[model samples]
Target: MWSNLPFDLLANIFSFLSPDSLACAKSSCRHWHQCARCLATPESPRRHPPWFVALPNRSRGLFCCAYNPIDDSSSSSWYMLPLDFLPIPTRPVSATAGLILLRSTSTTPFQLAICNPFTRQFRHLPTLNVTRINPAVGVIELDPGHQFGELNFRAYVAGGMSEAPGGGALDEPKVEMYDSRCDTWKVIGSMPVEFAVRLTVWTPSESVYSNGILYWMTSARAYSVMGFEIATNSWRELSVPVADRLEFAALVQRNGKLTLLGGKCGGDACIWELGEGDVWRMIEKVPFELGMRFLGGKGCWDGTKCVGNNGIVCLYKDLGSGMLVWREVADEGRWEWFWIDGCCSIRGQQPQNFQIKGLLLHPNLAHSSLLNA
Candidate 1:
């Protein structure tokens, strides 16, 4: 039966299967495995790799951790990636375009790291001349369409330092750009608003890159979003409709538009899509009962719109069950809840190693199989 199907057609069919399914298909028969491998290659027209989320396990005093959700039911496993290799006090701030950005929490000079789990290749970014005293770092791919070889991939680090007690500037915040191509760093510009030391004072939220500019949200005890042009190195503040102060929010790309997921203080979640002229319009809001209570005010916006892989948006939830669960946004504004059992522990303790720290879906690995086949 397999012999009758054209090779190209079979390869295309395998592309839609999940990573686990792709592995099973390979074991089904030599022909199927070969086709499956070919379809998984980065060069393949229909390639989708497994997605990963980083969750810190402060229990062991280790600032680094993550979890990878496997589709396999029988043997669900989560792996651990430690930051012991890097300097101390490093925490993951963002993941974009196949790279994870980890920043140091130490007051001593620190550096940022752009790591690729699949390749196990990491580039330690040079320290910015600008000091980041409690700053937020935002990362994004400069050109998603351009291959790593064709265009330079960059991550934009932004945020300001806490202010002094006497109503004076304690630390000036600045934005810096890291160029993967040159293996160098450059200061772009400083943040427009002066930041106060108060924890209640919202510093810059996560920044999202779109159309050569990066956007971030500034509460300022008032509500507003700002845009920074990487090329021109200029800052522009924009107004966003005032909403309840969210403890955790993220900037994500959906269908090529920049979207915001705001988690309010009361465990409510709302989705805002960037409309014409970069206006933010609220699209969907999670009802209070939809396991939103677990969000604990933190969520990651993955550019997925499907049930299985892409368009998966996760909000951290602390279910009364005493376990850390994730509320997954499903198709048509539906919500599904899944528990990461034995996955989380409080500071200074390590949870069971069932969770995966970092996961890389290499479409390129699929291509290697095609060559051998």
Candidate 2:
């Protein structure tokens, strides 16, 4: 059978395998290993359950934990990634299409780098045009129509605290983008000065890209969402559901749709999908018993944070209590939950004072043009 099929066709079939399975197949023999190398590029993107990455709060070392969604057994379900080979101290700000955008807190002007933790590939990027504190940042893959050989992407930084000439007033915020192809940064678009301040103060810098729009959960509670349409270079805001009553919430794009996962303190955690007319349609909810177990007598859900993309959404305690994940089964037309204990894999390596949070991304081990420089 192996001799009957073409080599390129075998590589294309290998691209359909899960990363873990593909790894096993690669190690089975030498010929398949070559096929696995061809799986590196985003040109033939593979499908794998988006895993939740638990990053230690402080960038003490270059080690972080990865949560495997497919593993349901009791064995170690996390991978402690040793990124010691990469130079400089930095933390991941955004991850898309297997590349992580890391920001260096040690430097002024906020140095950024693109690295693939899977392959130990690292490259430092040019400085952002604007120096901002808690800026809303995003890394989006610019569509190359699958025609170009090189991977093209854009990094965005919008709405953050910037220096002003006088101490008396607020400075207008600017939106800047970095092009991987050109290896340069340029101002793109911006929001209102007041709006940018609010986003900087309340919202996390992580942005979710869906279709042509980018969304960030704005405000302390699940009050509203700020959206930026890249095609139009415009900004828009939409109110979330049950803004006043919900104790916790997060805006995420899952299964290629903008969805919100949130819940009240004593109620079940719920999922809502945004449908036509900008309305939220109720989808699923965690059972009462499961919700209580997730809370674990915490007494409040305010510390919950949500991060997910594509076909998965993960809810975890900000204090590193544990993680509750819901993954969509496309063929089944249903969703399932997996609860991973937070204290399992990276316990001894972290101190009691440290906290951890997970960001969902499909890690690509392929070569990126961002590394060309």
Candidate 3:
């Protein structure tokens, strides 16, 4: 019956399916698989489940873990990703779709690589000319209407200090962007000294890219969320809510909007969204139940962190409190919490004993073989 349908009709049918359901449909038949690809447009608004990249306690490799709060607790949902996919001690600096931007090590003169954990396809990126003091990587989909696994993407490396004679605070910071089309990197623009100084002093966590802008928070800048526009190569900074004594904060893309999750030690936290003209609008309050629970019976809240994607957000305290996640329901006004215990436990573990890096990602079928095209 699927074979009889016109191509346009089949594309429309597959468009409404979730990412996992679409993957299942593609496996039904060759015709259905082709239809799935045709419908996987960049503009397609279909959402995928959020998966946490759990750092293993035993090995240097990472684990892709997902927990369904609605599912029975007895079943196992975490999958240990193969270590052979990338070099040892590879740090995933950024993630989009299924592709994660990795560096060989957390150290200087970073060797860049891109790999899709789902497909286990790995590809190396060009080496940077300068080692960033506290560098961050940002990725943008260049092809206006491309699909999930397509290689039409560009990577921008910004806010890193350079290695050169007379390297000082006055040294201007430049943006290096890699274009997949040319397969080369170029210096785009130099940011103002104030921004460069912050980058030098404080290395931000992995940045969140939405639309054409890359956003990250800086403690040195009073916890301001900095935005870098890829097209114009410009910078904009937005102040976060409750900046005083913010122990932890994260910027993530939810429902295609740039969202901020800020948490304080005194049981204060809230999620905010970028409103018109770069305004930070509070969307949802971090429920007191979750905050109080994170406090772990203590009267005051400790440090906390926010990690998530695809409308699901996880909050975990620094002192080994279990993870509390909020998953948004479609067309529903309420949000509920999901308990993800394995990944959140690493907060209390020794840094060398357990490495915890997470990205809320949707599995993508795109492969490195497409890069040959």
Candidate 4:
């Protein structure tokens, strides 16, 4: 009878399972697989809140150390998810929804793959049409189609320089796009040369995808955001607030809205919601004591990390400092901030050993066709 349970009841039961347990259930029987797959549409509610995953490159096999903000400093819990199943040395290029986009380090021109580490389901995408380093990577995961009912997404590499025709300098600025449904890449178009140079040289691969637009913060002196609209294959830029005064800045999609987080040198950290007409309005700011503590002894937010989605945003300052987690409650129109313990589980020989990347992801239990092997 348990196996023959009604579809509604079974889906309710499936919703209670954690991601790992859900994976086991999907593999246990054909009936369960069918049951689980039916419940995996984009409309399904996620089981857990967003978690901060501090991904550090490791040689003795890959392990994911994640921090759940709700656990509080007293518990200081960290979840370790092994990534040994993946066959290559790869860097996480971008993360959206339940999928992580990875770039392989083993190949001449880096290879790209999108995977759900929780389910151990992975798929490698075709080689990119553009060859460049450190380009702005973006991803947009859409709701399943009415016909196929399969979840789909797009992975984009924008504003990267290409080797010159004469093979002189890495000068051509172009955008490459990959569609998960087709598993292919296309050279979308060339980027404005100014943005391409900035992107190819050093923009953070972490990006914000919202409303079919992908956003990346530039490293230029006047810090502007490079945005790409997938539908039109068009490029645009948004200038950040107090660009010169701020020592730290990042773009985040908070609760389906565009947000800006930054702190000035020897000043308070701010959270701004991007308003219509390309304006920014303040939503919150760090409490003075908290901002000072987060800035560490250097007394500035230099090299800080701001990442989140779906109403949760996290801020991290280096030098072994803990993270500041912010949450917005929609029904109440309220917001709160708190501090959680840092990633102490990741061990290394000082800071010289590895590249540590961070992203805020809501751990999902349901099946994603995009990640299904």
Candidate 5:
């Protein structure tokens, strides 16, 4: 079989197959295994951008939907992924950067599973004992030198359980970082500020890493917002000028500036931008009628765009429906709406089914002009 087909051609065919298909192909025979393994190896030249978003489902558990911003016109392809192959918790938290990190259950010991869907390669991360009983997990890409071939990945687990039983209200947050290059974890230092004792199940208020800084909002038991810097390992109390009170706030980067978005404590949705000297300024108030809601709006900020769904309401409108609206602040800060359908939505009936666990964007299918040759 090896002599029959060109190895390069065979590798390209295997690259298009999902992880599950690759496994089956590997078992067919020795030749197939060699071909499959070569194609699945991390060093393979057929590596493609990880454009799939992992979503949780009640029936299928954790599944992934393919997303490609280049092919905005193509419908998204949803594929059910195998949870058994991965060491995922019952209530796992997932983050994507070529590889996906799945955090274990809250009650269980601290555990995580790092997976790369393209290569079907997975590594189970060891749990570290924490000072606090509950800790927050985050993933960030640091500047891995040119030797690693750009985008070296790492995971960080911050603010774990307090060591002392029945500790005071404020427990010092601890930080640990995992470097893929070294394939090990290290306790770096303690968080700059004290974290809330009660861990919120939702995503981190903000985990945007930019210019070597990871920014997130932490609330005390009193619900007061405190901002922290990961690079400098410092903490500070940030005053949100637009709202005296907020139910939840997320720190986002827009057009290269740090921004914040949240609903007022009284329930008015709003967006805020960080101005010079770290001053907070209100940019726009999202109208409730726009049908926008946020469950964990932390990852909503995708550079120039943000998307989230708390229930049926979505922050970004569908391009085909003529209802999806966006305000351009860098240009003129004017509101504009466009209609596009087929945008992913929370699947469920009314009332109890309104909760949206995930949001997905379709990929574009345009062929590269240079590839025509």
Candidate 6:
């Protein structure tokens, strides 16, 4: 009976399906696959905002949950990621264009794997030659037309302790990259002498890719943002204002602009946009009332985070307070907040590894079988 329906009606019905459900529907039959392709087409109007995926807490196996508040408000409604094809004891360091960069837990030489959680497909890259405890990781998906199913992307891993197997600390900062097209890894660049001196105690964090540059925040003598131009393979550094205060700040991209989230001296969280000449201009602050909701009208916030997808920005108070997602009401000058009750309740059993972070991925009908390992 379903097969007798018109193609338009079938496409319309499938439009409402979530990423996982849509993947399953595509495999149900030939007609359904055709309908799924319509939604996956580059010009389809059924594109949905990326879902926020959180890493599992303590379980031995690698587990993840996808939270799409727009489709379901309840935390329990989030879907589990199909990571059966990926490596175990692995942690995701970066996510971009529907792909995740995962590193195995093996000691010394760390192997890398890139996977698309939505499609349940993954490709293993060669192991990184580093002996550092933590390294900054980043990825750039070169899908100009937003064709997510196509596995065309590059991954970068940089900066870690150069301690060799014999326990001698080399402390040499290195950068290596993997290109999916070439299926090979190459040494792109190394840390500048002047920059390495200041990075004696570097903190391994995830790098943010915006435009063609990848930015990583380093915590050493002072806070600094290190940038690497993927196309040119050049490097530069920008000092973060009053680095101590923004110690745990998160770097995120908003509509192609670089934004930083940090707490004020008084403890209120504020959002700043990167401006020309290495200057940062304050754009938004957590209203007093909103801060009071999380602060209990007493002390300052512990710390806050900002994550964005498309134009939507999610201000998260990692200290148990619920998330506040907002977007400029198209053409309206004011921003609006999306309240997802019980959103913060779903914490990972174990926190993500030091170098791994959560990612916001847009919904797509791309499947894993189509991509090569």
Candidate 3 residue-wise lDDT, 1-373, digit = tens: 2343455446756876889999999999898888888874557555334456553322245454433332224334444455565556676676654577677664556567777876777778777666555566777756534566666677777766666676553333887888776777888887877777665566554677787788877887468877798778889888877776666777877777888887666656778888788778987876777666666656454445567665678775432236777888767856776555543322243222243555655556455564333
Sort the candidates on TM-score, descending order: 2, 4, 6, 3, 1, 5
lDDT of 6 at 287: 72
TM-scores, each model vs. reference: 0.64, 0.81, 0.75, 0.79, 0.59, 0.76
Task: Report the lDDT tens digits of candidate 4 across residue range 109-226.
Answer: 6578766766666767877776765567888776622222233677788765556787755755777878777878888877778777777775877788777788888868777888
lDDT of 5: 0.46
lDDT of each: 0.50, 0.70, 0.64, 0.70, 0.46, 0.63
RMSD of each: 8.8, 5.7, 6.8, 6.2, 10.8, 6.1
Q: Model 6, 44-120: lDDT tens per residue?
A: 44234556766532223455666764455355545555456654667766666566667766545657776776666
Model 5 spans > 4 angstroms off = 1-54, 57-62, 71-84, 90-96, 129-132, 144-151, 165-172, 196-206, 219-225, 242-248, 264-268, 285-289, 292-373
* Model 4, C-alpha of 109: deviation from truth (Å): 1.6
Taking the tens digit of each residue's C-alpha lDDT, what string does model 1 give over 1-373? 2354455446755876789888898899988878786763334332232444443422133323333343312223334455444444455555555455666555444466555543344455666776555555556555553332222367666665544568655555566777765766787776655532321146433456666677666666555666777778777766655444665455655555676766555445677887887688997776555433343323422211111113444443321112222333434455444544434443445544432233222212122111111
Q: Clashing residue pairs in candidate 6, if any?
A: 50-361, 50-362, 57-349, 57-350, 58-350
**Candidate 1: stretches off by over 4 Å:** 1-33, 36-42, 57-77, 117-123, 130-132, 145-152, 159-174, 190-201, 244-248, 264-268, 292-310, 317-373
Pick the winner on lDDT between candidates 4 and 6.
4
**Error at 204, model 5, angstroms:** 3.8
lDDT for residue 250 in candidate 1, whole number 0-100: 55
Counting clashing residue pairs in each candidate, in order, gives 24, 2, 2, 1, 22, 5
Residue-level error in angstroms, candidate 1, position 1:
28
- The candidate scoring highest on TM-score is 2
Please give, for residues 162-230, the per-residue lDDT of candidate 2 as tens digits.
Answer: 667776335447888888778899898777876787677877767888888888887665478888888
- Candidate achieving higher TM-score, 1 or 4: 4
